[model samples]
Target: MKITSAVVSVVLLVSAQNSFGQFPAEEVSRFAIKDFTFESGQAFPTAVVAYATRGRLNAAKSNAVLLPSPYAADLHGYDAFIGPGRALDPQRHFLILTGMFANGQSSSPSNTPAPHGGPDFPRVTIRDNVRAAHELVTQQLGITKMTAVVGYSMGAQQAYQWAVSYPDMVESIAVICGNAKQYPFGVIRLEGSIAALKADSAWNNGRYTQPPVKGLRAFAIHYAAWSQSPVSWPRDMLDSMSNQQVDQFLRSLEAPALGMDANNVLSQAETWKRHNIGDSPGYNGDVEAALRAIKARVLLMPCRSDLYFPVADAEYEATFLQNGELAVIESSAGHAAGGGADSQAIRFIDGKLKGMLQ
Candidate 1:
């Protein structure tokens, strides 16, 4: 990946508090699907998906948006961009926040009953996740179609999968800092990171009920290196963060929470490693043909300095999709800027999301 100079001064502004009506989180009714086996072929009585929503559904229920959690990070990560006048304004559209399978809060190894609570939990794919989200909309919420689906990084991957798996169910998709398929380098690095955790004596063969904090911390440290641009990530930033008293914040990027089993990480990592639309086996045809098959309007947003999902990847997808456009944010924040809640990304999304609605 080529690195470019994208330095821009950031002037932080704290908006005055307003008594704007609040939109609190509400849980969606849950359901268990017995026959829904995972990609790993693990048999289970049910597959549980957890989700929270804000705002109201229109009479036509046509203004719904599904926002899936990014890898490891929960629904709270996108909180800053949602509100009355924000891109995901609850006043204008109903936003559903869905947790991914590996997230400990939902159906993951750590939370599964007894035998399934550790290394035994089934591995799930992006396809399986999208299907579950579809069920959430159709069965749980009674939403037939969504006006748009938007997210960043892993969440953006889910957004893409949603449009691909159920073209008729989505009108448009806004993907930021993500790719249709995990790059070869990304796959290798993720595998190595997972292996590093398992290799630690603290892991104890994935049987430790409390979790291997040391191993998790190591993994997080390794990931911190990959999560941003080397040129832009100054030592001062790391030093400043290290000075903080909160070890949890330091390790938040590194380790999973207590009782959050490592197997879940391995499972999700494997699914990501195999993440290729062409992996459907024998669907090995033209890449553009597969992209052109999508019926939804597409917006691809990439930060100019992003390390993981490069601008070229988003640009390539936009060229293939029937109604897609690339909107690159010119900032030095790298992959972090894409999800870091920067002004440029926010401004681009605000305009594009509204345009898609019109």
Candidate 2:
């Protein structure tokens, strides 16, 4: 009997699921650091950093680009930009995607040993994540330099920190939809997110026996609104969702996060709260000095529609970078627009990055 069209559709769906299931096996690679010490003066006996790499490292070791993963995103989160013909252009650039410290794939509270597993994970800073990236490049990969440091959102925050912290190590950077400093609004949103998690009585001071579903659901609702622009809401995200589907949509977004320890979420939030390039020694809390200290080529892509990190933030910071240029992404994707959400954004960013790579 000939196969029915319905059967063919079912087969295709199963094929997609199988491919998704194999992602971890194909992409994950880890680097172990013995007796790691956080910038907070807290130390862990041993930690493993999760990462993924694409493209080929050149003979001179200069083709490598450090793409730091964003908040709550894994190493594979950058799949959208890494490929033969994508913006990252694996054909011409080696992409080293580093997972953020508390993001579970790395040495997160959820994955650490019993004693420091839940509420005991040390407070990690943006500087600490940059430190891990440095070690991953210098010690594990044996590279002294990188072609570019490309990042979005929290990853963009890392890109800024990397440029400021190690001026001589990077040749260029593309910081997208994020700022060099944690603005008051950024801190406020983070506080609200953490508060949502804590409001759940089951949080039990991060020692809960079960996940905090109620608080997490509330947190997800709050997060979903800020993730995209209100103007784009009717046409893009949640376009035709029924009242019931809206709840379903919110739950799916928060599901992955529900598996995470509340303390881990708070730890990363504190790091964000303290993010400021000026916090580095030379700047002494002066943001302008920190931006001025950057000597590498710079590409700043701020989204005009982004409420999280406003375009004005990048505009002001660009004036301070000696080699900086600002390219505003004119999409209504909000902060995500800079993450290459739409074709226009992808093209805009691809052009800028291609020029920088050249």
Off by over 4 Å in 2: 1-22, 235-256
Best by TM-score: 2
The C-alpha stretches of model 1 lying farther than 4 A from their native spots are 1-29, 235-260, 280-282, 285-287
Q: Write the per-residue lDDT of candidate 2 for residues 78-164, one digit (tens) a residue.
A: 665667776698888888988887876789887898787888888888888998889989999999998899998889999999998
lDDT (tens digit, per residue) of candidate 1 on 1-358? 1112222211110000000111232444345666677656767777877777889999999889888877665556466578887778889889998777876555877678877777777778887888777887898889998988887777788887787778898998888788777877778888887887787786777787566777766665665555556766444444434435335445444432332356676666776776765444335734456677778988888888877788888887787788888888776667766655366656766777677667
Quantify how close model 2 is to the true structure by its C-alpha RMSD in Å. Answer: 5.8
- C-alpha lDDT values of all predictions: 0.69, 0.77
Residue 39 alpha-carbon offset, candidate 1, angstroms: 3.2
Q: Tell how far residue 159 is off in model 1, in angstroms.
A: 1.3
TM agreement with the true structure for every prediction: 0.84, 0.89
Query: Which of the numbered candidates is closest to the native, going by highest lDDT?
Result: 2
